[model samples]
Target: MTYTGEVTVGGPPDTREAGDLQITKIAVGPMANNAYLLRCALTGEQVLIDAADEAPRLLELIGDGGLARVVTTHRHGDHWQALSAVVEATGAETVAGEDDADELPVPVDVRVRTGARVRVGSCELEVIEIVGHTPGSIVLAYDDPDGITHLFTGDSLFPGGVGRTWSPDDFIRLVNDVETKIFDRFDDDTWFYPGHGDDSTLGAERASVPDWRARGW
Candidate 1:
């Protein structure tokens, strides 16, 4: 059996209205980490996905209150570095996959398992545990009331590449998971947003997967 986790990234928000969920990408840290600010359209509930490693700079971006949650994609230093500070400053609870949940010093308010959902305002978020990038890497997908689905693939999948797998076992497992689980589940139009680089879609990459596996990357 293969692990099943798929994501579909949708188009960007055209309007930033009071009830429109918008995601702003902030490229920060030495590694050029892409931290995200997910603003809720209805209750104005906002969440941070992988805070800025440069603490001072991140604080400046969402300086004030209103941060509802801090969702860590994984336990990497670059991703979790600002978790504690952000939670303290914004009074937001932290959430992550159960396997890597311990990465946070403090207990995570929500432990995401496969098929778990997180709803904020008018947007609903789905969690998919994607290992191999790390033991506990996961992807996030947000579906608006209008039926647009967007994926937030952490370090699992990339634009022109996939996350490096030092072990052959891990590599094969990860690849199979993405193929049988993710790529097989979604439609061709599903959008893909990786942790690094720009976005792609399941439909676009699904066609090239054979070539991808052929290269043994």
Candidate 2:
């Protein structure tokens, strides 16, 4: 009954309640991409992050509540495999990072930059753009009234290290951005949900920053 943030392609989603919001995470596609469905407890307005794959299953999760918007964290094919399908079915507005918006399968209705806010009823998620993994990969931050921070990091970050980068400069840039913009700004109790695999707290991974930087990955 606990929310572990571990999910398989066909497994039931993991849901967590944070103040006025309900966060549901499910894995889909062969790449095991994680798609998050955020519902506003106050008004029942919903928003989805990454329509990764499995349109039918994602739709089932959406159910009769309908979806207001779909935010794609990056332009990676795996992350938006079902974007067009899901959007067509739900009529949800498409949101993505400004630099990567054009690369998605569907037209991006909202091109967001760092510090931009997306709404779900009365709740708001601030966008943080992290380069390297993709030109405009984003991480959404939700500051709950209950004194918790929840981050949905696309491929820009993971449990043990940051996302994969093609060059040394990119790796450095990614790590620096993550440290300054994310780690430094948020507290240790901040919980992060990655694009793939499990989730971890900043405190749990804080000590490994130097190690991750030294490896140059």
Candidate 3:
């Protein structure tokens, strides 16, 4: 089946193969948080993004391969609900944005900033920090050798607009950062996986940038 980037709490995850990497997305928790499991095809090394919930289910997906690291996109409770459990089970190193690292349940082993790189076997994911939804919410970009770029956006971005912000200034900051750092740098074919709900391409949502900005959300 094709990777639709759509999942529900009780359904099987959707996966896509990109070059040497395999990307699996599953939904968990009552909030319906999306958790991504990235596996390197070359070395079988795996890295998980957001241990949102359902530790047993996540572990089942991991199987016997074991996990190397778990990257929390933000400090939100829903995003890290199973962080402690998952890390304890796999002994995987914890990674999070520098500003939000201390807020997580586990001690973050890697506090990354923009431009930092996280490796999974021979594959690498570039980090891009977007502030507004949280002080240090981040998005990970993977430049697939055989395909287009793929982004794992936390609560910082969604299909229709940026993440929820408490203030007008925050909304503006998020929009500007998303536009300059993400939209400007990536192509229209870039596929983005959000923290919740479904995924979308930059081209599909490009024209709505002005509308999202105008609404100030």
Candidate 4:
């Protein structure tokens, strides 16, 4: 996928091709929510993550290719502001975590749990349910044949620390999930895409986990 000129919110959408997957990132809405389009280069099947905002722009990215599914990272309003519009325009199925599915404005087509596999073309993205950001916050992990892993973390993990939590218990749960489910399972080269900001890698954030947990954030 190629894009030119200014994007909906950020300067330009970031695109990376890893093996069979072509990932494109676009910032949308006043909140600068990151919406991603993951396409399988081999089969041309596409899946969108977080229809954050600016439906027309996201639809433009999909173009004539059509979208098979749109996955919401969590139930936050900012993440799904454009969800209804995009689904209406493309008739794509909606997928969300089972715990957060009922909180969404529209009915969820597929309620995914941790370890569930979401198919994109011939590729399969494993679902990891990480709570704290929300009771059902989740991240999508795709292990490429090349041995690199691509993570789509909603608001669960970020560059310097994990997602914000209101209580210490929530923070602990998120931290544990990040360490066990994400950090431990993937290698340092694992690339993580976040919901509202730039991307980060597990290698970059690995060493800082201890500090983040100590500070209790």
163-185 per-residue lDDT for model 3 (tens digits): 99999888989999999999999
Given candidate 1, what's the lDDT at residue 112?
Answer: 91
After superposition, candidate 1 runs with Cα above 4 Å error:
1-19, 63-65
Q: Which lDDT tens digits does candidate 4 get at residues 139-196? A: 9999999869999999999889999899999999999999999999899999888887
RMSD for each model, in Å, please?
6.8, 0.7, 0.6, 2.4
Which sections of candidate 4 miss by over 4 Å?
A: 1-10
Mark the 10 consecutive residues where model 3 has the least summed lDDT.
208-217
lDDT order, best first, reads: 2, 3, 4, 1
lDDT string for model 2 (118-207, tens) is 999999999999988888999999999887999999988899999999999889889998999999999999999999999999999999
What are the lDDT scores of the predictions, listed in order? 0.70, 0.95, 0.94, 0.90
lDDT of 2 at 91: 98
TM-score of 3: 0.99
Model 3 alpha-carbon drift over 4 Å, by segment: none
lDDT of 3: 0.94
Q: Which window of ten consecutive residues has the lowest lDDT sum in model 4?
A: 1-10
